[model samples]
Target: MKGYADRKDLPRFIAVFGCLLAAAILLGYVEMLIPIQIPIQGVKLGLANGAVLLMLYLFDAPSAWLLSILRILLSGFLFSSLMTILYSLAGGIFSLLVMTLLKKLRIFGIPGVSMAGAIAHNIGQLAVAALVLRSVESLLFYLPVLLVSGVVTGLVIGVIVRELLPKLTFLNNGGYQL
Candidate 1:
């Protein structure tokens, strides 16, 4: 694999990364607009993850990590609170790590990778919540529901990424054939 330093189209890479970051932020805002109330707190479609997954597949681990962190920080600052930022940072890191590992393993498709990411994200948030509450009981009660939501959301994001991949002419033009 060629390193970022070895790439000839650095400008193109930067532009693509910027576009992905914008898409993630936009998706985050869109998700916020749709007030889907679940019984559990902090559970949503995670639509922004589509951009993250797309970055992971089209770019590399470092790129994906950077984008995820930026997305979490920016979105949290713009639309949420400090506490939300903490939870989102934790979840985003965990999710990205899991997704990157799964992607590296090459044993699963986009849906499987996305599902694992979603599950890991929930687990990360739950851990933080448990720590804050000084007990896991309340959060534990919501695990099953969160897991199901994760699966469904992950599948949807994965399918969206898969469909979008073919239409990304920039990636193809950059000489990185997906």
Candidate 2:
């Protein structure tokens, strides 16, 4: 690994990473506070995804990935259980990959990418559920509802990111190029 001294912008990079991670975790906590009253076990507002999407757009994939992982770990430790971390890890990785690929392809705007990511995230968690329960048939029955939820939540998150990105002028205007 290169020394921090060799990279003049290492501090800036770390600062962005820290800020985004904090934002992701904080938003995730806020999501927990605002109960959705949904009956399904895995359905979530996914409000934290907005920060992850912003990280992806503002930085490279690797940085975005790190943010996702760190956010999951910290949030898991502070708020939830090991199982939550496992499910989130799976979903977040899947969601990030789908969003990154769609963005790279440039075939879809942020909303399209967000919707795809949302669905992918649910699919990922469903896969984990099937593995844990050893009942594919029962889990398969729950897929559609999760998919629909993912789409709705993902769109909401994407729209939030799109709207917030423009307002963050310091980050967008090259005040910090991380």
Candidate 3:
């Protein structure tokens, strides 16, 4: 069986993880300032997830998990309170799990996998927030809008990754380094 840490891709993993972390922090700040409201609360473009989707297709699960954790940590330190860390971590893990499962099942290829990850990430975060706030009502109104937004935004990010993957030769199967 292939162990998580045993995965041969290292340099590529580091590169992707770093990129994801930077993107997450940048987007986290942007989201904080703009704070898009969908008339429901906690619904907005998690544009940083673009990097997460890219990593999911380029590397393995553990690598993706590492990237997510790094992003949450960095974003927490830079943008908001440590309490926000829980929501971010939960969303990241949930997103990674969904993407990994979809990839295992051979779903809609890399782009589709990325989309699935983004969508799940949003839903997971919203669900956690609803639970924490003790406002089940928010979930009822928010879920559908989130689903639509997730699909659209996820697709855009997925497409971007798909196009960029070809030029990112470092991520090629044999080129990944530690």
List per-prediction Cα lDDT, in the order shown: 0.86, 0.83, 0.73
| Cα lDDT of model 1 by residue, 2-115, tens digit | 476577777778888899899899999998788666656868999889989988888877888999999999999999999999999899999999999998888888889999
How good is model 2 by TM-score? Answer: 0.89
lDDT of candidate model 1 versus the reference: 0.86
TM-score of each: 0.92, 0.89, 0.80
| Candidate 1 segments whose C-alpha is farther than 4 A from its true place | 172-178
RMSD of each: 1.9, 2.8, 3.7
Candidate 3 residue runs with Cα over 4 Å from true position: 1-16, 30-40, 171-178
Q: After superposition, how far is residue 142 of candidate 2 from its true place, in Å?
A: 1.1
TM-score for candidate 3: 0.80
Per-residue lDDT tens digits for candidate 2, residues 33-145, read: 88656888788988778888887776667777888889999999999999899999999999999988988898987888888998998999899989999999967898989
Candidate 3, 43-92: lDDT as tens digits: 66667776666566666566667777888888787777887888888888
Give the candidates in order of lDDT, highest first: 1, 2, 3
Q: By lDDT, who's the top model here?
A: 1
Superposed by TM-score, candidate 3 places the C-alpha of residue 79 at a distance from the truth, in angstroms, of: 0.8
